[model samples]
Target: MTAPLPSLRARVTPPDAVSPAPTHGHPPLIEVDRLSLYYGAARALHDISFAVPERLVTAFIGPSGCGKSTLLRCFNRMNDLIDNVRLEGTVRIGGEDIYARDIDVIELRKRVGMVFQRSNPFPKTIFDNIAYALRLQGLRRKSEIADIVEQSLHQAALWEEVKDRLHASALGLSGGQQQRLCIARAIAIKPDILLMDEPASALDPLATAKIEDLILDLKQQFTIVIVTHNMQQAARISDATAFFYLGELIEHDATSKIFTNPARKQTEDYVTGRFG
Candidate 1:
């Protein structure tokens, strides 16, 4: 592996790379305006409008099939791959409408990374898995790929455990390590936004804690949006939380307010375990 740099992030990222939460001058980095989605004839998301600030964790919490994951897919147009999926709202990232006809989805996805509910590493060596996307993006220099792989693993907090066996098969790792590896792979390109869907639901408590810590650290570099069924997990790692039910966004607010003093009765009930 290449020797560690003093500050790889400083060289690759600007101090104020992403816009802050809506304020006097700083606009939210991501804006979803009156968004609705459909899976064939069935509507999945109602008119959902919200803003995601930069460098913070915004988590989506809801019962199963309540459109949490569906809405997340809308961020990078991942829903487009599903047959008969249609969207009718503008999701703008960094002031550009992602649904615009002139947009390049391939490049858009490069700017927006994703981590699924399950850890899905390609059947490749650990080093190769992290380097795969970089190589596809035309990073042909071996030294550059090695350096980035090390940096990404370090950022994901997996380097200390896996540095000795960079060539090991990803499948040979434990469940938690695999998830962190997936996270490492996603961050290798340093996307402006990161979307996750129940990334730790399958893991044990200790592993989940590591993933949560990783998410909190990653928010400093990427605008993170996560969908989770674990309400406590959402409260612990997210700066803000959005509650969903039957395809409708009930309420969104700061984590503390959402849990303790939500504006809506439904939100209160859901958080209080009164109903699904």
Candidate 2:
């Protein structure tokens, strides 16, 4: 099934993942170069250029409909799923152009995982939900799959909460737990990057704080790119912040500078709550 996929050992600890990734570099792990996107004839993203360092959090913030989510969708080519979507320029992950004719979209998705604004867990038992992908990939060894499930939940900071009820339906979980389960499911396959689209917007304050803490811890292993309307959330967890307005990338810089000493007036004004 699925061509036997990669062995659990190989997928669990990829070579590059084990290597220490420098936090600074020229050709960053994710590079968006002069990129633009269009829905039919309506342009959604302007020429957006940025580089995301490995194992760090980069936040995209702006007023609603400013194209933050649209741009985030580009990282994994999720936009291609929509009808009549046209993209210009390129998005490269690990130096390979994902839009290339020979690239495999399925394989790309395995490397770049996504978490949506709302958590959507499968109706199956929690254990089955995490193991579904493994089984589909021909991983028949229960011990191996169980190990990965436990590890993923631990990484998502969910092991302690749901470990005893692994056989229960995932629907029985709280919204926050469901969200963490979604995150655990995404990370179960060992994606190099995790793309989050307002992952904590719907959670309560305490739940949101847990999620924020989880994001901070997760950045040590996975490159994270998040789209958030809550500027405070961005400021709390992101290493860098990009400001988008009217489909344009107004500024992208260190979170500290973006908040305290932004180079762009537009960024300054937006961050200060003058206008979004």
Candidate 3:
């Protein structure tokens, strides 16, 4: 029989190996250099910066309204959708400035997909939900679409559970299954980075466990960035963790160190439940 999938712990690299700068290894896949964001007169993120390695899970963790989610949206420029928003500095993916005047927002979003806290499946069949994104990208052949739909579902770890009822309505699935369907749809277009904002916050314990498992398997293929308020969950899945507070990035390092021996008193307080 085929070997079972490895657990999350099996995939973690030691803390010493995780570094902010290039240390005889591949350069970061995503780089944020002194980035700051403002909503009108209110600054949502101060001068913040960090680098994210490819094919690993990097999590942003902090208390509510701490700008973790705001920074996550900056990766794909999701904040541009909001009115009166201004930004400074640079966010580069693969060394290209994402905010450059020549960049195409539509194509950028295609390369970097997002899954929100609440699962949102189209009001269509499970097969169609996955196929819809492919069609939007101009893949019209039924055979090609079918193949991609299957591949995406398998990547999201939902193919076997729904293969027999591909035509069934996605709305009929449980909250957890709907979230997985949304994940499958996001990957159907073959994006390089996956941004998850509190992806498991809406699910029960069992479903949350499944989502965490899927994240572990997915990091082998795609660069994953997530924003979560759950400190324990961050310790469990992330290779590196960044602690944000009051719009600033307070500390960023290997997940193990951030949890056990964070550099800042503020970070320690937040993680240890002394204060949010």
Q: Write the per-residue lDDT of candidate 1 for residues 1-276, one digit (tens) a residue.
A: 112223312332111212123222434778887788888899999777778877888999999999999999888889889999888878899999999999999999999999999999999999999999899788999999999999999999999999999999999999999999999999999899999989999999999999999998998788899999999999999988888888877667678878987666677778989888
State the weakest 10-residue window (summed lDDT) of model 3. Answer: 1-10
Clashes of each: 0, 0, 0
Instruction: Give the per-residue lDDT digits (tens) of candidate 3, residues 1-276.
Output: 111323323333222222363212545889888888999999999877778888878899988998999999998999998999999989999989999999999899999999999999999999999999998898999999999999999988899899999999999999999999999999899899999999999999899888899999998788889999889889999888888888877777778888897766677788899898
TM-score of every prediction relative to native: 0.90, 0.90, 0.90
Give the 10-residue window scoring lowest on summed lDDT in candidate 1: 11-20
Tens digit of per-residue lDDT, candidate 2, span 199-258: 999999899999999999998889999999899999999988888887877667778878
- Candidate 1 lDDT at 256 equals 85
Q: Which TM-score value belongs to model 2?
A: 0.90
> How accurate locally is residue 39 in candidate 1, as Cα lDDT from 0 to 100?
84
Model 1 spans > 4 angstroms off? 1-26
Give the poorly placed runs of model 2, Cα more than 4 Å off: 1-27
lDDT of model number 3: 0.86
For model 3, what is the alpha-carbon lDDT of residue 37? 91
In model 3, the runs with Cα more than 4 Å from the true position are 1-26
